[model samples]
Target: MTQRVVVDPVTRIEGHLRIEAETSPGGEITGAWSSGTMVRGIELILQGRDPRDAWAFAQRICGVCTLVHGIASVRAVEDALDYQIPPNAQLIRNLMIGAQYVHDHVMHFYHLHALDWVDVVSALKADPKATSALAQSISSYAKSSPGYFSDVQKKLKTFVDQGQLGIFANGYWGSPLYKLPPEANLMAVAHYLEALTWQREVVQLHAIFGGKNPHPNFVVGGAPAPISLDADTLAATSVNVQGLEIVKNVIARMQAFVNEVYLPDTLAIASFYKDWFRRGEGVGNFMTFGDFPEDGTGDPSKWLIPAGVILNRDLTTIHPVDLNDPMQVQEFVAHSYYGYSTGKDTGLHPYDGQTNLDYTGPKPPFEQLDVAKDYSWLKSPRWKGNVVEVGPLARVLMLNAKGFEPAVELTQKALRQLDLPLEAVYSTMGRTAARTLESKIVADQMSTWYDALIANIRKGELAVFNDAKWDPSTWPSVARGVGFMEAPRGALAHWIVIRDGKIDNYQAVVPSTWNAGPRDEAGKPGPYEAALMDRHTLADPKQPLEIQRTIHSFDPCIACAVHVVDPQGEELTQIQVR
Candidate 1:
């Protein structure tokens, strides 16, 4: 007999996600399903709206990755009008996006994903002196003293003693799956607190350039910050000499944390769980839109992360990705709570994408989703009819396959340190390790971009905004374009169709949608479902910690996946997850 285990509203992630697994009598998972229970009708809302104002609305897709959608939205409009921004503007965008990668990755590791590996209850048993020694052994992060870890332990003890765990509530605290020792767990807890303080300082870079952190202001042509060297104006008023100095300091601080803390912690923790490198290798194909353009946006060769697809884990050949090619990329709604104009089985390219809600699953508060019928709100997106995993791992693999020296060197060094083969990168821990490595790569690149920006400023080239196509009246009567970038989670692309200067149709195929979506018309399991099946086993199905470890590895941002609430407003299943 197969037992069905359900974990609803998967916590620590951005939005609601439910994971249902079928386990055999021996506890090995035989199959699984991934569902985004809610619907995000942002595309429907975007229709008939002014194309220039789309960024403001689109940026609200997810509060966690606000600026990513904003950047892609404006880029879509720019692509439609053939708008070209200044070199300095490109550098600034690169710096901002790079900062997001560093900030987002660090936070995800410490706050969101660390608990899966580090046992909090065990941390209370840890000797602060031993933790301090362990911290120092890894890297020279200044807050490695015994006193610092002691304080963190005391705070955690207070939470556990008070019968109120707060964010740490209902966790499988002493689960057998936790591999890190008491000292290592204590060390991680201390850094978790430190990162809380560190993130506030790092976000200053975003505020300095974009006028705010979350939902930062992004213009259609270029950045909103105006460059000036005038000493008379206040530092807050403009991007002056003082402002530039602060930006440099922020970049330095970001680099310091990635090197001294994030990278070391990831490797140290990963060294304890080598088995993870063999499991959770779902849908071996990988894809990346390729971010951080070194030159103008039009050329793919100049991109730091190249846009390409590697099928069946074949590093020998990288398939090209053409956004305009309708036959190449398409989305199917067969297993989703959506319908198509042509038919439910039909796959439509993003350019002609449709959002028609047709919920035919079990009502709310149900035990399991009707996997045989429509289940999730996320449409199954396919790259030439194959499921492809994206995000940091994909980017790193692409860089290595393309013979990018820095990425290749870093990947080899990591693989050697872990005593694992290159193929190990296809698993869950590989995703986490790849995130840390990419942070180092991106943080180092920020310094180069910062220097370029300073050089442009020193040469008296203060131009940031381009107003050539600011007015929608200058656009063609009918225009369509695709704006794509590699978000912190994975590949993200926005497709827009404009008619008479208004958005006729808009579709955002986000990273989470690609990774966490349901099955397609062909009955092929998506990335999340495929990973959970065959290899996963539940030591305790009630606590489902094993399920969370794999799901959180992808950093599922369901807020970016499903947005709109059903007007009928039926209360579905309510399950508590720590």
Candidate 2:
């Protein structure tokens, strides 16, 4: 008999998800379906409000990267109003963004993604002394911890022995894909606890400027900091080098762990569970809306990582990210509930746009191409007419292809240090390492911009902000603009329309909208759907932790799109029990 196995309300990650895998009687996996069940209408909520407030309103979409939305929303409005922010304001934005990348990347690895892979149960067997020795042997940055990991281990041991998982209460631990030895698991577990502290310290970056994380309020005209300009307070205007230094040190430690600990751990785990690399591999197409600090200039291409597109299984580059190029971008909502003019192109400004909601059951993007059916509210997304991967994996692969010499050199060094083949740099392990590597690049670029800002300030050239005055009256009789920025997740796009000074319409295509999206009109499965098709299922369903680990690696953030909930609560609760 064919069986339908459901893993609903996946825990330990942001938002809600219910995955159903269909198995044939012969025990081979035949099909999979991804479902999202949440309802958030930020778009609908902002229907008649002042366009400026859209930034304030949209920023509430997600707590982790609230500032990103704030920036994107305001930028979208500013694009609508044709306003330009000042130089110092740009620097502040860059600094906050830099801090965000550091904070989000670290949190993703340690708190969110680590538990999925790191075995808490196995940690009880690790030797503190051996872990310390291992730490000191790999990188001196670990020395800064000074028994931090040991204390964390002791705390975890207490929690586990008490059978009070607490922070780990909802984690999937007994999954078969967890392949770490007891000692390694123990070491990773301690780091996981230590990371909670590390993550808070990183958040201080956002606190200093935007005031708070999880939706910082820095917006269009300028950040709210409004320097007093007093000589003494101007002195206070000095960049928080100490905070930046802490972040730098934390990143150094992270790189060390990636090189010394995590890389080796991944290889060891993958060796034991090689089936992962062979299966769950989806369409090899990848895309990156490139990001990095500006060299006191507006030339994005000169930024550390230039934006680009990649296609095909072997990964080839396509240059010059042209948002207006019709052949380069299109959206098909055939399977989505949203109403739009059929065969609409995302490039043709939002002013001349249409949105309609029509729903149809799971259907293939094309004829003779159904594996399973999508029950997701997400629309199947395609990039410039092809299926493409996004996130750290796509970013890393694109950077690797661009031959960004620094990233390339560092990646090679990372692979060699772990005694792993260079090919290993191409799998799930590669995704984790790429995030850390990108963190280093961003941190370094941030320091450079800091120095440039100081030079501009000393030269009395820092423009705090451009005038926010705009004749909402004379505004383009009919204007449409699209804003694109690299969010921590991947490329984030917002399409805006303005008529008679009120938002005629606004649409945001977020990162989750791409990664977790259902089938588009063409019937192509989104990236995550294709990736999960061939995963190995354990004999015990309760141990679906591997699924959790693999999916979390994408750092899926569904909040920006919609809320996913499970109505069949008892059925889900029972799966956890068995």
Candidate 3:
């Protein structure tokens, strides 16, 4: 008999996911499906709206990566209009995007993903003295925030004492995957607390460049920050060296945790849960749209992180990407609930695309080719009929394939420094570590750009946005453009069709759409679905947190791709804690 185990309303990550793992009588998972059950009709809401205003609306898709989406949407519109902003605009965009990365990554690590690995129950067993010592190793700021750890401990105690885990109540603390002693857990718990403090610092980076966090005001041609060349303006524009230093320092603290704590902790857990590396290791295919402008060229190949597509299973090398080439990219809304004209459910350009929302359960084998029976909010995205993984794993995989010396060297060094074999760097742990390390790489490279801008300014190279003449009438009668931005999660692609100075159609095949997609035309499972199949389910379903951590490590932004719903959908009273 097939039995179903479900975890509805998976929290922490954005969106509500109802995951059902179907297992045989022997307890082996035979099939698993993740459904995003909430629909906000963001696309439908954008209809009849000015193309320029789409970015502002798109930014509301997810609170975490709001600015990234906003910028990407604006970039798509700009590309559609063939409009280019000035150098100062480019620099400001870079600054905003970079700040988002730092803020998003830091928050994701501690607030969203940490609870999966951290055993809050173990923190109760920790000796406060030892925990304090671990904090000192992080940095002076960590040491100074003594009460933060205490508060976290108090909070955990209250929850555990109250017999309600609240957010963590259902977690599997005794699972074999949790190998850290109480002391280590205490240290992580302390860092988790301190991380909340740093979140404020990182968010200031966002407000400095973009105006706000959830949705920043970013103009298409340039930033929305009012330009000023006066002394006071220069002082405000002055790169907050200390603020950046605090971020670098905080990340360094995180790195210490990785090297001294997380890496070792992961291996220890994996040693007991060795079965995971094989399971949930979906299509070794990885793709990255490299980011960070080099010499102010929008050419992706010139970006600090070079963009490339790779078939990880075969390790095929990808050539340079061309947004103008239609044959190179296509979206199949076969499984999605969209209303549109349909042929083979596959086509090129804004005209041939269909948006029909007729999900008739899972694909019946005969109807699979017809694209009518598939059920999913996610569109089938294939890089030449091959499922490709996108995120840090993909980033590192492509970097390794290209033989990028610095990236390769850094990977090896980071792996070695963690006392793990080079091969370990290829696993889930490495993915987590790669994201942290990428920040270091980005920070160093961004500094070069910063210095260049400064030198140029001293040499009378002006870096200020001037007025731009934008005549919407000059736009094509019918124009289509693709905007490609490398989000913290992975390559983010947006296709926009504009006609008569208004948005005709727009579609975003976000990172999660690739990672968390459903079945496609040929009956091939999506990258994440396939990855989860091979996973050896631990003894208790409560420990599903392990599975959650592994998946969330990629920082899947499902909220931006599909819809979701609270399975319980029950309203509870909110009581303020004074």
Candidate 4:
């Protein structure tokens, strides 16, 4: 008997995901459909606006994504106008981006994804002293004392006493799938609260550089922060001696947590879930747009994370990625709620992408989405007609493939600890593991980037913005370019067309759009759908912890799941995620 299970609006946090899985009589997921219930209209709003101001609006696409869209938007305009920023601007951008990567990944693991594997309610029975021993056994983090763990446990007890587990509710707390002991659960929950405090400190990097966070300030040709070392102007600028020292301190804090806390906890937790390494390997193909440029040359080879595609899980041949190549990178709306001028089944390059709304899904108060027709708002993105999974796994595989020594050694070291071969990295647990490994890699390297910025400052290369193309008359009549980066989630790129000094067409294919999109023209599932069908079986149909595990591994976020309001200002869909 085939049973259809609908998990609509997943995640207690802001998510617009709707997963419908068809399970066999044995509770094995045979097929799955991933849907983004709300429309994405940010690109449409950018039409006819000043090209430079697009970043301001584009950055608002997602609140949790931080500054990724802002970075992509500026890069798009710069690429379109052939505007090259100074080396200092590039370095500043890298530092800001690197900080976000470490901070975002840490938060995702502890706050968003941790509950999927951890049994929160089980922590109440834990011995705080034993929890301290578990914490010390893994890493030398300073807060590993019986008293510290006891306090954290008390906080949990208070939440439970109030008739709710607070932020930790709605999880399969005592599920048979949660293999961690009481001590491990308590230790993880303690660190979860610590991460919330850790975030406040790291965000200072963005405030010092971009002026603010959660939609920071960004300029098209260069960064907004100016370099000035004079003591009188020191208080006004971010590149002075005082600001640099603060940045150095922030980097130290990031390194300490990733090394002592985050990485250790991941390894400790993985010890109990080794079997998960065999499943959730979705669409063996992967891609990266590449980011963190070291120079003004803007070459992919010089990038810290090299860009390429790995097909069929083969690391031998890494195919190159070209965003502007129409035949290579295209978006398909066949299973989506949008229409293309070429055809519904046709694939169009992002520069020629269309956002015409043609929603044909079920009406309001619907129990289940009709998987047969346009069921999602996200367009299926493909590289060379092959479905590629993007994010940490793709970038890690790229690193290992490109023989980046740190990534190669890290992967080998981790697999050796888990007592598994390299092939295990091709699964769901592997994806989660890859995110942790990369966090350390990026965190440690932040110091190097910081040092280079200091060197540039001492040598007096103080310019952060390029004024070469500031005048509109200097630009050509028409231009189009693609700005791309490997966001914390995965490959993120924004395509822009500038005509007559204004925005002509704009399209942004974000990370979630690639991973959570519906099927393509040939009827192929996206990464989430494919992974759900890969060795996934529901232990109890009522509590689908298995589904949450794989989905959260990708850190799924439907930034486009905006509101659906009628003409009279009433919400069309009253979808409450929690």
Candidate 5:
């Protein structure tokens, strides 16, 4: 008999996500479905709006991803108008994006995903002295003290004793699958609390450059901030020498944490979960838009992370991605709660993308979604009609395939530490490890970008904004282009269509939409669905820790997956966890 288990409201992620899996009698998962319960209609809101102002509205797609949409939206307008920003602008954007990677990756590991691996209940049994020893053995982080671990344990005990585990509640703490000993769990928990404080300091980098952190202001031509050297000017707001020193310090702090904390913690945790390196390898194909421009944003060759597709785990031949080509990138809504203007079976490129809502699943508070019918709000995004995993793992694999020395060195070092083969990089734990490795690479490059910016400023180059195509009045009647970058989670692209100086149409296929989308018209599973099917087994169906371990590996951000609310405003579905 096949049994069904559902994890509704998959907590700790950005937005609402519900995962359903059908298991064999013995608890081996036979099939799975991934669904985003809400709709994000920010694209439709951009219709008829000025192309110059689109970045402000589009950046609101997700509070967590913050400036990525803003960056992409501005870049799309720049690409469409053939506008070139100054060199300083390019370097500033690089530093901002690089800081986001380091900050987002570390936050995701410690706050969002660490609970899946570290058993909090087990931490109570750990000796603080042992945990301090373990932390010191792994890394030379200055925070490794017996008293610090003891304080963390006391705080955790208070939560449990008060019947308020808070964020740590509802976790399967004593599961057999938790391979880490009590001391290791204690060390991870300590770092988890420390990351909360670390993230606040690093995000100041965004405020220093863009004027704010979340939903930072970005102009279509260049960065919004100006360069200044006036020591005492109250009216003029700009990035002066003092501000530059602050940014440098922030970068140094970010690099220190990635090296001394995030990387070591990931390796230490991974050493105990070696089997995960064999499981959760979904859709062997991978894709990346390639971010961090070394020179100008227009040149693909100058991207620090190269954009390409790797099919069937092939590292030798890299397929080029032309976002404008309809045949190369397309989204199908066959298994989604949407209807295309043309037809349900037809796949549409983002340039002609439509978001016609058609809810066909069971009403809210229901048990399981009808897998045979339209199930998810996310449209299945396919690259050449194939599912490709994206994010740090994809970027790392692409870099390794292209023989990039930094990526290769970091990846090989990690593999050697775990005593695993190269093929192991395709699994669940591999995804987590890849994120840590990527942070190191990006953190190292941040220094180069900072140095370049200072050198340009010292040479008396104060040009930050370009007014070449700032005004839409001097533009083409019709223009369309794709703005893409490798986001923290995966490949993210925004396609824009402008007509008569207004946004005629806009479509943003975010990173989570690519990884957590439903099956395509041909019934091919998306990355999340494919990874869970026939690979995971539940020791306790009521407590689905196995499902979380695999899903968190992808770091699903459902808030970015489905966009907007219906005008009718009626609650369409209510989630029922069973």
Candidate 6:
């Protein structure tokens, strides 16, 4: 006998994600379908707009990933125009991207993903003194004390007694799937609260560089903020002596927390959930578009993260990736709620990508998505007709394969501590752990990039914007380009064609679309579907904490992957949070 389980509007994620699974009588997930309920029309919105202004509109793809889209957008315009930004601009951009990586990974782990493993209700049963001892044993973080844990427990107990978990509501509080003991649970809950406060300090890096956040300023030629050394106008200038010092201090705080709290917590929690390190290994293939340029060259050789494709978990060879190659990266809409001019089965490269709405009725009460037809709003993106996973794990795997020192050292250390081999990093627990490891690495890089910026400033080199190609009259009659970065979630890119200084065609193939999209024309599942099918068993289909663990491991940012709108350019649904 087979059972169908559905989780609609999957909570704790950025956008509307629906998962339908078919389980065997033994409750092992036999099959799964990943669906992005929302429809993304940002690409459509960019049509006919100024090529230079695309970044402003594109960054609205997600409120959480505020700066990444702007980065990709500006890069696309720069690539098309063959524009060059200064060395200082590159370093500043790297700092901003690094800060985003650390901030995003921390937030995802604590506020979004950690609850899947740590039971808040269980923390109430913990002995505060025992929790303090457990915390101190694993990490040197100073917040752990009997009184501190007791106070956290008391606050949570009040929520439970008052019949309002508030932020902790709707969790499977007593689920058997959660492996953490009460004391460990209390330790994790304390850090979760701490992370919320930690995030506020890090985002100041964005404010310092971009002048604002959740939609920061950007320009096609270069960074919008000019570096002003005048101390008198420190308050008014985006990049000033005061701002740089604040940024330096913020990097220190980020590194301190990751070293003391996040890394230790991930390892300690993984010890209890060793079984997960062997399961939830998704599609074996992975890809990264390389980001964080050392100089302003935009060459793969200068990027901090190398670009390549790893096929079938093979560390033996790294395949070259070409964004401009028509046959390399293509989007399939056969199973998506979009259409191609040729046919649904036909794949179109981003340069020729289309966004035609082909919504089949999604009038709820779905026994299961019509697996035989279009089921997701996101288009399934394939590389050379093969499914590939992208994100922190993909980048880490690339680093491990290429023998990047820090990644290799961190992976080996984590593996040795857990008594698991290097191969274990391919599992769901590994995916979650990779985010934590990457956070530390990025936090460290933030300081290096900051020092470089300071060094350039000391040398009296203060160019953050390039006005060489700022005027549209200098652009060619026709131009096209692709801008890419390894976003916090995964690899993200924007392709644009400019005709007569206007956006002729625009398409963004985001990370979530690559992972959360539906099956391809060949009927092969994407990463999310494949991961859930990888030895995942639902202890209680009603709760489905098992499903949440695997899915959250990918850190779904559906709002960036898909959007919502009808053909009439009007709202189809008004989602009320209540």
Q: Estimate the TM-score for candidate 3.
A: 0.84
Per-model C-alpha lDDT, please?
0.89, 0.62, 0.63, 0.88, 0.89, 0.90
Candidate with better lDDT, 2 vs 4: 4
lDDT of 5 at 222: 86
**lDDT (tens digit, per residue) of candidate 2 on 1-578:** 87766677666567776666666665455665555556445665566666766777777778776677777777777766677777677777777777777668777877777776677877767677776665565445443253666676778878888989887876666656677676667666765665676666566656656666666655556665654334444212333445434434544544454455444444444444444444454666777766554643446767665677776646454655665455665555554545565452232233333445434444433222223332566555555667766776677677778788877787787666666665554455556666777766666666666676667766866465555545566577666566667788887766677676777777776777777776665666776666666454545554565466556767888877674234442222211100
lDDT tens digits, residue span 509-550, model 5: 999988999999899999999999827889899999889988
For 1-578, candidate 1 gives per-residue lDDT tens digits of 99999999899999899999999998889999999988988898789988888898899899999699988998898888888988888898998899999999999999999989988789999999999999999899898898988888999899889987778777788888898999999888888888999999988888888888887888888888788888565655567777788889999999998899888999999999998888897899999988888756567788889989999999989999887798889999999999999999999999999999888888789999889988899999999999989889999999999999999999999899989999899998999999999999999999999998998888999898899888877889999888888899999999999999899999999999889989999999999999887378889888888899899999889999997574776653332212
Work out the TM-score per prediction. Answer: 0.97, 0.84, 0.84, 0.97, 0.97, 0.98
Cα displacement (angstroms), candidate 1, residue 104, comes to: 0.7
- Using lDDT as the measure, the top candidate is 6
Residue 256, model 6: Cα distance from true site in angstroms:
0.4
Screening candidate 1 with a backbone cut-off below 3 angstroms (N, C-alpha, C), the clashing residue pairs are 39-563, 39-564, 40-563, 40-564, 365-572, 365-573
lDDT of 3 at 165: 74
Tell me the tens digit of each residue's lDDT in model 6 across 98-143.
9889999999999999999999889988999999999999888999
| Count of backbone collisions within predicted model 4 | 0
Query: What's model 2's overall lDDT?
Result: 0.62
Candidate 4 segments exceeding 4 Å error: 232-238, 560-578
Ranking 2 against 3 by lDDT, winner: 3
Kindly list the per-residue Cα lDDT of model 4 for residues 1-578, writing each as its tens digit: 88988887688544588899999999999999998877777777789988888888888788888799999999999999899999888988999999989998999999999898889999999999999998998889999999999999999999899977767767777889999999999999999989999999999888878888777788888988887786455523555667777889999999999999999999999989998999998899999989999887898788999999999989999998889999999999988989988999999999998889887887766887787788898899999999989999999999999999999999999999999999998888999999999999898888888889889888988999998998999999999988899899999999999999999999999888888888999999999999999999998989988888899899886873332425454544431211
TM-score of 1: 0.97
Better of 3 and 4 by lDDT: 4
Model 2 is weakest, by summed lDDT over 10 consecutive residues, at: 569-578
Candidate 4, which ten residues in sequence have the lowest lDDT sum?
A: 569-578
